[model samples]
Structure formats: structure tokens, C-alpha cells
Target: MTSGSDGRRPVLTGLGAVSCLGAGVGPYWNALLAGGAAPREVDLPHLNMRATRMYRVPGAAVPEHPRRHAGVPLGAVPRMAVAAALEALDDAGIAGPDRADVAVVMGSEMGNASVQEERRGAGGAGRPRWTPLAVAGAAVGTAIGSRRGNIGVGNACSAGGYALGIASDLIRSGEASVVLVGAADGVTRVGMGGFDRLGAADPQRCRPFARDRAGTMFGDGAAMVVLESTTHARRRGARAYAELAGVAWSCDARHPTAPDPDAAQLVRAMREALADAGLRPDQVGCVLPHATGTALNDAVESRALRQVFGPGTDRLPLFALKAMIGHTSAAAGIFACLTAALVVSRARIPANAPLEQDPDCAVWLPLEGPLRLERPAVLANTCAFGGNNSSFALTGPGGTT
Candidate 1:
């Protein structure tokens, strides 16, 4: 999975995350390895719902950024994005003149929805706190001084992966040498109410692929990754955590909220993504699935996995992060991507949280403890509303098969 002669391949140089586990990437990774849970009662009194549990970042765990946005009143999502973006840039050692060519691409399902709700609650008497462009991408671009461009994607839960794919395209097309890409989402009254109305909110913790799994619990968090062209990375002497081997997306277009039970589109996305990487299913060390814990979602995803990996699917390790961090919506895809990056870097798969394996989910889930990877490549999957599905391949710095 080396870059072409022109160094167009995108390599992951740095990662930053503000998850329910904590603010820094170290804490998030540690919590995943420890199989910790951070569930708390949802406090939104405005939303009427039976499912009230959610995974929230502690108030103290929120990173402070005094210089971000200066006098502009920043929303929680943008603030989290700025914090994560700053950490990513610092982690990548990308500063001075290198910052000028960077592009900022972020995704969010509910961009400043909380701010909008607040303004609406106030009867719009005061100055509005949010704008159409008050998304994570704008805030990150402002904070990082990215002159190339700022783009925001609102592709539901799959937006994060879409952001990464878009950034890679930008680099490959020579539109930008570097791109800061990821996603962020904060809880909002509208978001919670909508899920509750749809009966998709889990009353307890998220337990993906578990027998009694009811639904997904919402989580607040953000994740950012620094992507640079191999040529630029080499010229700047930057160390890479992983390479973005390949990414592909597809839409089922069968239903607006529920995925097609047949999973035909998802299978195509996975196969096309593998083809793009020029790798076989057996070459992948593990899979990070978008297991939302819902009965239909888990089952559909399992069928898709079986279709793509065949009998080998039963033996391939499946790492379900939503069980640990809850589903972060727009941030979910990149969070999984970051976890994959860590998995390849460490060569170990974090254990899926405790759960009674669902007979319906035919994939192998490592619940006992960490499972060591035999190879450095990982396939990360993400699916969203509107029947959108995305799959991407990531390889460690050592390269892929």
C-alpha cells in the first residue's frame, strides 16, 4: 500500500479525540483497552423519552481553548472540533509554513443544533449564536489557519468516513498537500427527541451484537486526524500512524431510516473498497464494524460481512467500539477509524465490551480480551441514515498486503 511515484496516497500522521472516555487520544485508547463504560442519565428535560441514558464527556474533561474563535460564541460541537483539531496539528508537528497548505474538512449530523435550539428557546430576541457555516470544519479551519479550504459534510453517521475519503481525494487530486479531517457532534434536544420518537434510543448502555441489544445510546465527542500526502510527509520528516489505503461509499436508497435488509449496497461498498486497496479479504487483520446494537442493524451488517468475507468472516476479529463509547453520530465513523489506526499501530485489537453473543450476528467478536492482529491492515465500516454506507481500508506504517 505504498504511495504512487507522485506520492498521492494519504497517510495518517496524527489523531486527536475528545470522547466520553476523555479528551486526549491516550485516554480514549486506554479506556477502550480497559473496556470501560461512561454511561450517564440524559439531562435534557425538554425531550420526552423513555430512553434516557447517554454517554457524555465530563465537564472537566472538555478541553479549553481560549484562543479559538476569539470573541465568537462557539457551540459545543465546534468547540470540541477546535480542541481536537489543535491537538491533531500539534501531534502532527505541522506548524509554521506547513499550515498554509492545509485543508479543513469536518463532518457533523447535527451542526450547531444545540445552538439553534437555544436561540429558538430564547424566542430569537437576542443575536443568533449559530450560522449556516457554524460547523466543525469552519471552526477547525479558523483555529489551524488552513488557507486551502474549509468543507463540512452532513452525511449522518457516515459523514466522518466521507470526510476522510474527501480529504484523500483532495490530496490525490493535488488540491491540497495536507488535510485535517474528522467529525464532531454534541447532544441536542432535537436529536434526542427524534431518536426517541423513532424508538432507536437505548434505555441502557449500548451493547452492539449482544443478544439483548435494544438500540444505540447517543454519545458526545469529536475526533480529528491529520492526513498528509506521502511526499509532503517525507519532505517534512513526519512519522505516519497509518495509511489510508482505500475508501468507497454506496447508497442503498431503499429506505430513509432503515437499511436494506439484504445489505446489497453495503456488500458492494466493502468489496469495492477492498478492490480499491488492491487487497483480498483474508489480508485484512480485523474489521471495525458500524454495529449500532439495533436488532436489524446488527443482523444486516453481519449478513453484509458474511457476503464480503465468506466463511473467513467467522474467524476475522470484529471490534465494535460503539459498545464502549456509544454512537457519536457524525463522529462515529472517524472514531472507529482512529481506533483502527491505534489497532494497527499497536498490533492488538481491543476487546469488545462484555456481552452475550447474539446468535443472529454470525461474526466473530473478541469479548474475552484483546486479540492480537496477524496483519497490519484493518477494514473500518460506517453506515448511516438515508441508506448511506461507507467502507475504508487502513494499514499501519509498515504498509499493507
Candidate 2:
């Protein structure tokens, strides 16, 4: 007999997503495995980002379905969040039309890129600021609410993954037995232009950790998970994707865009994560790298990764979501985390399209294949421009994994 969800450690029971690849975790996973689409050209209306080659979820549809109260607005960040959250709720069985014992933890990196644009426009005209949608639009917690879980975190690019980590904590604290954690971001002209100005965006595409990589291509999407303790889960006869084992975060406080090259803080965070999980660096089956494909980030992360995991850290399986879906800012962290989970569920990771092994990345790159997992445990890493670094660990339940 299986132990009740509450009796067992907290684990992710369900997942939902709306990414540049597509809506729904199933579609995105299929596309990712099929190598259906890589980033491409697009126009961001908010910043009037014209003639820009960016990553986008092709044929993305936010249908005005009756199920979601007329559905979310197509192509909008909030819309994506709402859609993804509802789907996550449904997947988690939290949608038994019950709103109790559930809370929402939502995080976004580009939160309401349009609001800033409007604010900038109004400021130029000396106009007073007041728009209900402006703040609400970007607020992930506001975008979607759950019966018991609602937490918002913005740790730069680590926003979403951090949200999941904190939600796991909330469960550990019994704040909410079930937490709906969400991460979302928008690809507005303002957002993309800001990165472009920072020289963090490629005019064409994203090639994470690639030696010839230029910069990340901006993409927009949402990713979320429903986490619950084992006792509650079994009481409700729920299934679980994996148990959330550990998470760690740190800040270099170095530069706004450039990371602490040595990544001392970053390495410590990863080590702490492994320690929290009671696992060794060598036990790490795979590492979901935060390779932005930029010279500095890749170099810094590579250095830190090698230092922590050492010689064979490169032997660890590596899969960069940005290479296929582009970077979703706040969404990147959790999306990558979900990718880790997906790898567990699928027991394989898709190839990195549009990305080739670089002389530098070769030391840390993993082989692409009919991905297989022996233990179903994974480590996901993220770093932000403001020196934010974090790592989280999770594993499949039942030892059946």
C-alpha cells in the first residue's frame, strides 16, 4: 500500500505550462521532444519590436473557452498565466471545484512589460498614473489565485524556480498542504529592447552555452506545478510526478548584468542545495544549466559548475530549454525545473536544436539521446543579473523511480 501524500514528503503532483513551444505541458513536451520548433522572427507590439528574430510559441491559442470564464487574452502574459494556472489546477485535481487548502505562488520576470511602457509614455506627458490593469496585469498572484496557495517571488531569471522552491517550503511549514506555484513572463518590446540594449539578446536566435552564441532570444510563456505533501495526496488518492527534495539561493552583488566571474556565491548555493538534499555532487544525474549562451554567463556558470561538481560534472546530463524555447525571463527558472521533471517523466531529454557543443561547453555538455533516468532525481540552476543564484533538487516518488 502506498503512504498517504501528507505522510510522505511533499512532491509535485501535477504540472501546467504555456510556453513559446505551445500551451499545456503535454504539447510543449511533445514539441520539445520532436524538435518541432526553434525560436524564429516576430514582432513585439508593446515596444514595437519590429524586424526582430525572436522565439515564440507558434500557433499559440488562448481560446475563449467557457471553462476558464471566457479564457485568457491571447498573446498576453497575464492571459498565459491564468491559462497555465487553471490548467495546473485541473491537472493537480485541485479543480474538483474546490478552492480550499490551495494557494497560488506566482512569479514573473518581465511582469507587465506594457505597464512600464504606458508609465513611460504618461510620464513624458506629465500625466497622472492610474490603471487597474497596469499592476494587476503583471502581478502573477493577481493573474491567478488558488484556494490555499498564493506566493509571488521575483528573483530575476530565477523567479519561477524560486517560487516553486518557496512553495515547497510552505508545504513543509504546513502553511498550505497544496500549493499552486506559477512562473510567467512577457516578451514586450520594452522587455526585449532592454535586454537588447544590455547586449543580452541576439538579433537572431538563442544558442545557450554555445561557443558561437551571441545572446538570448526573448520568448514569453508560463510554467506551473501543483505540490502537495504525501499524506494529503494519498488521502485524496492522487498521483505524484516527483518529490521536491531541496533548493538553495545566493547573490553575488557583483554587477547589474555581469556575474561574479568566480561565482563564489553561486557555487556555494549549488553545494548547499546538494547538502540539503543529502546527495553528493556525483549523485546528480543531470544538471539543468542556466546557460544564456552569452560569453560571461556561460563562462561564469561553467566555472562554478566545474568547481562544485568537478571533473565529471560535464558527465552530468545537460539540457538547456532556452535553446529551443528561448528565454522567458521569470518563466525560465521554473520552466527549466519543469523540464527536469519532464525528463523524469519521459526518462529522456530532447536534443538542443540550433546549438552545437562549444569548446568551453564541451567540458560540461551532456550527450543527447533517448534520454534515460535511473534515479529520477534532478538539479535545476538559475542566475539573475543582480547576482541572484539558486539551485533546487527534486525526485520521483515510490522508489519505483
Candidate 3:
């Protein structure tokens, strides 16, 4: 089933976030409007890379409970996921008993790799517990008392978008009334080392669509949103932030690490997602592009936007969220979605991070300040390695074609 003006449509009712800005949704939104936070030096064991800056989560922001899951030491990633999940459940009014049937879906490329990294740094002289990529979802499931299925997605950076799509399908197909969908990733030695080795780690900050953009910076955090069927939400009198109208996915098997320079698959994903939502290119008020400050990625996405939106693409407000929050990798898609939902609910669009606009990426970005959201519907795109791409559309409550 697809979203529409019907009872089966999926709508977002609650949001939770833990980012460099802080731990709550209020702080995260306020920071975005206040021009975002600056990157800081992060000292990791054996991290000997020229690019040492990242939007690291403050020590106080991580939760203290669930220190260990089944004898495996829970790292910052799982802890942050737990915190965000609890907050989202509370916001959605899903008490412990009510959440027994709620399903959970989380996306994370690295998962709790930090625990293993620490062990390796300590000479591997401890118990043989392993923290796999499913730890984040498992941690949340255990915390929320969710007896239903718990699925973990690892589609590289676009994992969060895929997870959201799966949750929406479950709700629409009558398999679950509500789904706790989220993504979480903590900066790991391997992730940092790999990027540094590939020369994709930006030395300064994340400046997407910038002329002098070097590469992308990594950020660590978790974001969660509670999605429920329109009928179930109305039955429970749960307030909705926005309707998740549509989602589409595609893959460009042509390249393993690089996006197809022609961007044919990316363009198709955008068009199909809009079509699924029954919206025209002109109806989308804003977009959150997967602009990761990479040279070719930014340029290719710019060309794709022009192809999908035509000449009017210049007028669309593109929220370069990664510029402010850094690329949260696998969690980025959900973070972008949560940001879009806030734009619809609050009727305001946060300003983009300042940058010397790149001519090749000729997309409009409002850097002056927050602007009134003239249109209610928004679109967000996410791409990952292996050429996996996903796009989703969202509209405000009571939105009509």
C-alpha cells in the first residue's frame, strides 16, 4: 500500500534526536536555526589521520543505562539509540505495555564497532563478547519492550532511508500498527581510518555545494521517529507531525563506491518517489539533498535535481543539513527526515550553512535566516556506497494534492 488521503496512510507522530548540538529535539532544531555547531578535535586510539575533526557528541549527552546488553558492553552508539528511542516512545504516548507489539527497525553501517575498537586498543585482553551491527536495534527493542520483529539495516549511508521505507510498508500492510524506526552510528576508528585512507575525510568542516569543498566529515548521533497508520493514530488521538506520503528506492550497480556520474538512477528515484506521492515537481516546497561535501557527489546530485525539477530547481529551498550536523552516515536519512517533519510542523525552514556556493552545484540555499515554509510538502534524498539510492516525500497534516 502507498500513502494517500486515506486511513492507511502512514504519519509521523513523535521524534527523538541525539546529535552534536544536544540530546533533545528542541536543542537540535534550535541549533539548526542558530547556524549549527562547529567541529572539534576527537582523539581516538591509533587515529593518526590528518583529518581529525568531527561533530562528536558531548560526553554528557549519552545515556548511562543499559551499559551492557547480554554481557556485551554497550558503546556510545547503542546508548544514544536507547536514549532517543525512549524519548520518541514517550513523545508518541506509547507506554511500555502498549509497545509490546510495536516493531523496531534501525539502520547503522558501523553499529557498535566502538566496543571492539576499544578492545583492540586495549590489546584484546578481555571477554570474547562481540558487538555486532544489530546491537543498536536490539538495544532499543529490549528497552522499549518490543516483542515484535526487530530488523537492522546496513545499506551503508542510505540505511536509514531504507529502514524508514520498510517501517512504512509494515504499517500500510497491516503487519504492525506502529514502528519505531531510527538510525544510530558512533565514530569508529575503522570508519575514520577508511575515509582517511580514501582521502574523503575533509580536514576542515562539511561544506556541501561549496567551491573549495575538500570532502565529507563524519558525525555521530542517533535519530528516531514514531510512525503509525493514520487510522491507528486517529483511534488513539495521537497528534501527527507530518504524513509520510511516499518512498522509492533504486540502485546503480555500475559502480561500487562512486555514484553513476550520469546519475540516471538517482534521477529515476526522485521522479518515482514524487509520482508515488501523487505530487508534481512544482508542489514540493523544500528538499534535503544528500550533499556530503564530496566533489563529484555534489555535482552529480545537482545535475539530477535539475533533471527532476527543471528550471524551477533554482527556486527550491535545499537544506544542506550535513553542513551543520556533519554526515551522520547511516543515520543521515532519518535525521534529514526528522528535520523535514519539523519544517512542516513548525512552518519554518532552517537556514543552510554558509558556504561559497559552487557554480557546478547551482542549487538555491537560503543562508540569511529561517524562512517561512510557503509549501507544506518536502522531499529528502539519501545515497550510499554500492550506488544504493532512496528518496521519500512528506506532507503536512491535512495536505491535499
Candidate 4:
């Protein structure tokens, strides 16, 4: 998809990730192509939950320098965000004054929950007060030396997708030429306990689209991307991986934590995102679905993809990323988009995690091996608590400049 007449469509020029697979975009993509990492027992103190296993990032991969930012003590979540954001800026070849005016937008549901949890766990005496929940964006802004703005998106699991969309708007509207978009989260005691109480967490592993799928598993990490206007990238001679051609958001508001069984809003979001990108359903090569391993969510997304793609749904390759990295909550959307961008640039779709297909979820998911991405564009879906849904499209590098 070409940028609109204004040639201001957002292009993805750099990607950085910290995940269970490892740090950096290279390890993330390489591990995805190699069947992805498995979940392991995580050490979440005060988390009295049966579902303790998660796709936790390695200790060595997380950076520990810059322990404090703007007087706010940094925790794992903000530290991961800073690491990923700096990597993205470096990957994009953005430095010095060039980074000064770049805006910082981050989506985080639990923000610095680990910091708060630590304070509470330690009786909150003698130690400084805990950082705010929106500290990740500020942390990123300071790390990148950006004074333009620090915006936060709190749309639960779909926050990352919303952050990307907002960054695109910033560039297209001439508000900024370059924007840093990212998301990060660490395990939170309340989040885990609430999921356990609601019976919405899988104890063994996340098995989306499986006949006996239990519930989604939580993963912690950060992913960052550098989005720039097409003209800006060309001026700097930066190579783009993909064009963020379309972004659409919708709300179901049907339930606080459950998706609407009918999936009306989700289907609409997918269709509208394609329309926004000026793409036909047949042009999309693959999909990164928000199949959270929950029985209802997977089934609903399966039906929703069918509604949007119709007959093409049968042949489309669906990459169930959560099965590999577990659900990153607010970071899931950015993770999916990063995966989609890689799929578009590399022309290959990674294999989905192994599972026994559920007849109720009829969408196609190629688990045999890596498949060639034949089409030009890739689409991704992200839905969150309160039925907030987001869908976006990325086209091959050739579709950009």
C-alpha cells in the first residue's frame, strides 16, 4: 500500500525487543522462526496463584544501569522499556539533536507495578515512595533525550496497538516527523491473583485454538519501534522494513473482561483497517491473531477472522504469538505488529506453536513449518479487557518508498 496522497504514512524503520526469547530484534525473530521459547516458572513474590509459569525474559537480557530516572527509581518494567527504546533509536540511526524532538508514546497496563509490589512487599517503610504507573513513557523519553512529549496509552492489552496508531497520526498530521512507540510490563501480584480468581490463567502453558485450551498465560517484556514519515526516512536514507499502512480501533464494551461472542466490533475493526489501508482481503498474506488461549476469546477471534476474510480465511496463515511468548498484556499489540512487520519484510511466516486444533475455532494456522508469505500485506489483531479492540496492517518494504 502506498502512502496517501500526502506521502505521510508511517514507516517502520527500526525494531527493538526484550522478550523471553532474548533481547534485540535479531534474537526475537530468530527464536520465532525456530519455534519460540517455552514458558518457565517465574518468581513473582506475593503472587499466590497457581499459574506461575510465564515467558519471562532472562535476567542477563534486562539492563540495570540508570537505576533512577528523573528522581523516580526505575524497576524492571521501566528499565526494560529504556533498553528497548535506546536499541530502537540506535537501530534507526537516530542520535544527538535528531532525537531531541522525537515524541515518546508507550502503552502499559501495569507500568511499574513491580516497583509498587516491591514497596508493599517490604512494608513501605524507610524506602522511597513507589513510582507512578505511567513512568515507563517518561523513562523512555528521558533515555531517548526527547522533550517533545510523553504520551501513555492504558487500553489494557490493546494499548500497544493504540500507541502505534497514535504515533502514526502524529506524523501524518505533521505534529512530528519521528516518534518512538513502545510497551512494557512486568508481572504484577494483583494482576495474577485476579486472573487466578477469575480462572483466566493457564497453569501449564498457553495453548490457543487447542481443543482443551485452559486460559491465557502472562508474559513480561518490552518492544519498541521507530516510526517516521516516509519523506523523513528518504531524506535520511534509512531503510524501512514495512509501511504501517492502516490502523483502526473499536470498542465492544460488552463485558469487563470477556469479548462479545458475536465479535461484531472486532470484525468491524479488521474490515475498517483493511479499508483504511486500501487493501483487499486477498492481498493480506498472514495474520497475527490475539488468540489468548481462552476458550471464548480464541473461538470468538476465529469466527471474527472468518467474518472479515470470508473464504480466504481458510488459507490464511495465523501466527499464534502468545503460544510462544505468552501474553504480554499491554505489550502484546506491539509484539504482534513487530512480528507482522518481520513477516512482511522477510516474506516468511513463522510456524505456530503446536496444538490440537479445535473444531470450534476454524481459522487456519500453519504449524507444519515456516511458510512463504506470498502476499504483500500482513494484518494483526489485539483485543483487551473492556472489549477494546485494535487492528493494523503492514505492507512489504517495496510497498513503501
Candidate 5:
């Protein structure tokens, strides 16, 4: 990783999102401030399971953008991704000649499982179709007229954080002046069924850190951010939301479907990420935890926090986004990132509404209402199945530039 003295700092200029709360960043931020659960019963006939509730993006809320995959079979994941990418580009004011050198990076877990199921149900007879996993980057890049390059990340739930990290490296290395980073996942029969088989699906809404917490329920959504080198953004006079200070990745390799009980590797990831950003744990005013509402995940993450933040961990305001939007799977990390960026920029943490407190999960979570940030930096964490872990340090526009 390059140091801040290297003449480039990756900065976020634009954000886009499609989630259960609504489409666009404005609606998503508003819903977070409203502080209520938005999960509804899953109505897909093919996805019959014991856990029936999920947070889904309303059809009316999906943005209608010009399709780049016309006549090609596309899935909801890529569609949502393209919508988000377009919004990010527009928000960043990167258009016409400026987009020629931009890149697109996307991430997902089960790419287009729903589309695959649909094809299989149709007797598997069709023309050559583009898989959601294969065409996500291409579709978004083509839609935005970005011919520089396209990359896709499939690192489970941590894919979004990985995508952002890679995008920042590209900018820091002078490979691209602007990059669109994002992730998307659509709730599918195969995905829900797999979780049901594992008995990790929650029938009720996600309630992270709650004593009665069961497991995580899946949500369908996509989130994207426009990252550009500070020099490039300043040259264009673009407004910045936050600086993408640093990001680090790690894996525990403990279990195929469970996080390591010790959380040593997770702790290293967070500490290294803070070091990479040239910030201390005490400097991080807020944390966007990967609190999936599972009994083990919440407890393990709390332990990791205590290890990193020490005595200050008890008061380090943690925000649980999944409780409002449900777990967005691969897109969960970026959702947390976007929310944290907004929190730091706005200087206010959104309220967390866990049902009840769990004695084991003793992290500082503001359940009564929102809290003001005395510091400017925020840390976002993502821990995925198969032991993939990622951490990012972000600061407001006035942060480290």
C-alpha cells in the first residue's frame, strides 16, 4: 500500500444505492435516520423456506436507466449494479470525455442464481446468455462508456470491501483517474435455500446484539461509490464526501460457514487497516460493524472490537445497519461503507434499534437514539463466510487531505 505522502489519496465524490429503504443515496440515508425495520415476507414461490421474511428493494424504487444489455438476458443483480453505477457517475459529474479513462469494479457472491434457476426451469433451452457473475463489470462499464477496464470480485460478503480496496489501489498507483466501485446481490431460491439448510436464516427481522438474536436474514440491494485521486477531484472541483484512507484484507480459514471463535485474524485486519490509514483506534469516532444479528458473529465482532479499541471500546458508538436493511450479502460491506461515509460527513450517527442487549456482546451500541461524532474518522468492518475478512478506514472531506 502507498503512503499518504505518495501524492494521491483516494477520495469518494459520489455514492449510489438500491436497497429496501429505497433507491438513491438520499432515500437510503433518510431511512437510516428514521430508525425502523423494513423487512417484509418473501413472496417468491420458488424460495419457500422456514425463514420467510427479507428486506427487498421495492420495484417502484428501482431506477430506470438506459439498458446496455438490450436483447441480452440479464439478472436483477447486474441491473441494480448498472443503475447504481450510472447514479454514481452522474453524482460525480464524470461525463463525456472525462469517462473515457474510468474503470468499473463490481463484486457479488451468487451473481445470478435466480437467472440460472429461471433458465433451468425453462428446460435449459436458450441462446448464449451472460451470467450475472460474468457480465456485471462489463454491463456497468459499457453503460457508463468507460472503456479503461472492468473487474469483478467474488469474495463472498466481503467482495464489496475488496472491490473498494482494489479501486483505491488503482488510483494510488496512477492506473486510473476515476473508478466506479460497487457490489450487488439479488435474493434467490438457491441462496435462501442454502441458508435455510444451514439454519442461519432468521424468520424475524435482523436484530444484532439482541439477547434473543437468532440469525441473519438476507436482503437484496446494490451500492456503488465513485472514487478518484485527490488531484483529479480537485482539478475538476468536485465535492468530496469522504476520503478512502485505507483498506486491509485477511482470512481466518477456520470454518467454511462460521467465523473463527478467537477473532485474532479479524483483530489484525482492523489494526492493520488503521495503521495503513495513519490513524489510531481512538481516532475512529464511529464503527460500522458487520453485525449480522447472528449469535456468534455479534459476539465475535464485539471481542475483536475490545481487542482493538481497548478500554475505549465501551463508548465507541457502533451502528448496526443490517437491523434496518437485513443482510445484503456481498453488498453488505459497501452498504456499511456508504452509511459510515455519510455519518462522518454529516457528523451524526444514526440510531440503532436492537430488540434487547446481549451480555456477551458488550460493544457500545447507541440504542436509545443517534449520537454525534466528536471525531471525524470511521471504521467499517466486513466478515464473511469462508473466513474472508476486510476492514476500511474512512474520514470526512475535511479529514486527511
Candidate 6:
């Protein structure tokens, strides 16, 4: 499986993420691998997301910040992105985002929650007229730029993961030498209500791979990584987090809200990724699943994993991040990928919270706790409501400082 990029592989140079676990990369990473729980509930402004406990980033985590482009107010999307991207930039040891070798791909499910609220209510005082500034700020791409390079990407819950795939493709296509890829989504009234209506919102909490797990809780978060051609990164003496090995995408071609449980196409997607990486199924160490806590989704994932990874699906350590971070929706895939890479880089897996192993889900889920490994390859999986299935095969770097 040769990389499409002039045969040059792309490597992960930096990573940053914001979650209910913590604010910046350090805090977020610390909390994620700690295996602890917080007294958290659905925390959103000007919204009623009750009967659910979620992972909310502290207000301090998203402190007031200036917009990337002056005039734009640094709102939730930007706040989340800046925290993650800045950390990545800092890690990459590059000041200023004006490098021609860089490219940006930012993904979001729901744009700015605050802005959407304003637009929906703009009806206030009179038939609300759309504000140009408001509309621009709400654009997902504008909220994320490298000052160096820019490309905005969005596709429902698979946004971030797909954006990462796009970034890898850009590099593989020889369009860019280095790329910054990220994903962000926040808890808002619209998002909460939508899921609540779908009967997928767990009012109490999020429990992934749990025997009694109900559903997912909406969460707000952003995750970013600096990816560069392996040659470029190695030449610069940068610390590599993991190899952005392979990525693949497919549509259920089945249904809008339901996954193709038979997994014919979904399994193909995983096989494609494995082929792209020139790796075999047995080489994979863990599985980073998009277990949304829905009965249908969880079961579909289980069936697919078994088909691809064999009965070992039960033995594979399935790191269920949503159990702790809730579902970041569009940012979910990328966030899970980042966490998986961190596991390889840090040599320690992040534990799932509120995870109760069910006879079904437990057989294939690493529900008990985190697992440690030195350098390992993992598959990060995500599925969108429209039968969109995406997967990224990643191998963690050798070491972490």
C-alpha cells in the first residue's frame, strides 16, 4: 500500500485537543488518561439540555481570545480551534502560520452554536435581517486558517476525521508539504434538541460499551494535529506523534439514519485503509470506535469489527472516548484518532468513564480500563447519520516526552 503522495508518507508532528476532560492539550490529555469522572451535566448557554450528564469544557478552558482574522469575534468554534491548533503549532515549534509548506483543513458539524442561535432568533425586534459579519463568522473554514494555508471541510459527524483524510490526501497529492487538520463542535440548543428528538440523547450520562449504556450526550470540543511529509518532518528534526498511515471513506448506500449493519461497504472501507497502509488486520493493536451509544450503532460496529478483525474483536482494546468526552459529532472521528495517536505516543491508553461492559458490547470493548503499549497501530472509526462511514489507520510514534 503505497501512499498516493509521490510515495512519500505523511507523519503527524503535533496534536492538540479541547474536551470536557480539560481545556488545552496538556490538561485535556491529563484528564483523558486519568480514568476519573466529574460532576458534569449538559452545560450549555441559553439552552435546555437537561436529563443528561456530559463532559463540558470549563469556561476557563475556552477563555476570551482574539479572532484569527481581526473583525471576527473569537466565538466557540474559533475558541475551540485556536486552543487546539495553537498547541499544535507550538508543539511543531513554528511561530506564525504563514509557511507556504503548510495547509489547513478545519471540520465542524454545526458551525458556531452562538451564531446559529442569533440567526434563528434574529427575528427579534423585527424580521431579523442576516448580518454579513454574523454569517462570515459562522463559516467553519474562516474560523480556521493557518495564516500559512487554509481549507475548510465539513461533513456531519465525520467532519474532523474526514478533514484529516483530506489533509493526508493534500499531502499525498503533492499539493501541500505540511498540513494542519482539525475538528470542532459545541453543545447548543439546536444540537441538543435535535438529538433529544431523535431519542439518542442520554439525559443522565454517556456510557459507551456499557451493559446498561443508553445513548450519547452532546459535547463541545476541538482537536487538531500538524501533519507533514515524513521526509520534511524528519529533515526538520521534529518529534513525530504517529504516522498518518491510511484513510478510507464509504457511504452505506443503505439508509439515511441507519448504518449498513451487514457492513459490506463499511468493511471495505476498513480494508481499503489497511491496504493503503500496506498493513494487515493482525497488525492493528487497538480499535478507536465511534460507539455513539445508540443500540443500532453499537451493534453495527460490533458486527463490522468482528467481520474485519475476526473474533479478536472481543480481545482488541476498544477505546471508547465518547464514554468520557460525550459525542462531539462532526469532530468525533478526528478526536478519536488524536486520542489513539496519543495512546501510541504516550504508550498509555486513555480509560473510558461510565463504561459497563455488556455481554454483547463488552465482548468487543475494552470497557474495564486503559491498556498500555509502546508503539502501536490503531483504527479510528466514525459513521455519520447519512450512512457515511470513515476510517483512519494510525501508528503512534515511538516515544513521547
Worst 10 residues of 4 by lDDT: 122-131
TM-score of 2: 0.87
What is the C-alpha local distance difference test score of candidate 4?
A: 0.89
Q: Which is superior by lDDT, 4 or 5?
A: 4
For candidate 4, write residues 204-231 as lDDT tens digits. Answer: 9999999989999988999999999888
**TM per prediction:** 0.95, 0.87, 0.97, 0.97, 0.95, 0.89
lDDT of 5 by residue, 303-401 (tens): 999999999998899998899898999899889888887987888998897567899998888977678887888999998888999999998763552
Ranking by TM-score: 3, 4, 1, 5, 6, 2
Tell me the spans in candidate 3 whose CA falls farther than 4 Å from its real position.
1-5, 124-129
4 or 6, which is superior by TM-score?
Answer: 4
Question: Any residue pairs clashing in model 6, and if so which?
Answer: 5-172, 51-203, 52-203, 97-148, 210-356
Worst window of 10 by summed lDDT in candidate 6: 131-140
Candidate 1 positional error at 300, Å: 0.3
Give candidates' CA RMSD values in order. 2.0, 4.1, 1.5, 1.6, 2.2, 3.4
Candidate 3, position 308, lDDT: 98
> Highest lDDT among the candidates is held by which one?
3
Candidate 3: give its CA RMSD in angstroms: 1.5
Please list the residue runs of candidate 4 whose C-alpha ends up more than 4 Å from where it truly belongs after superposition. Answer: 123-130, 398-401
Q: What tens-digit string does per-residue lDDT give for candidate 6 at 1-401?
A: 35554335788888887777776667767777676345375544455544545567777777465443444344576677767877787788755444444667878756655554655554554543333322212332343443455666668887777787888888877778788788887766777777777777777767766677666776777888888887777777888888878899988887878787687778888988888776688778778888888877887787788888887665677777787677888789878877877877776776566455666654455435567753377888888878888888887542111
Global lDDT of each model? 0.85, 0.70, 0.90, 0.89, 0.84, 0.71
Scored by lDDT, model 6 comes in at 0.71
Rank order (by lDDT, best first): 3, 4, 1, 5, 6, 2
Residue 156 deviation, candidate 1, in Å? Answer: 0.6
lDDT of 1 by residue, 190-309 (tens): 877788788887888898899999888889989999998888888889999888888999999989999999999999999988887777899998999999988899999999999999
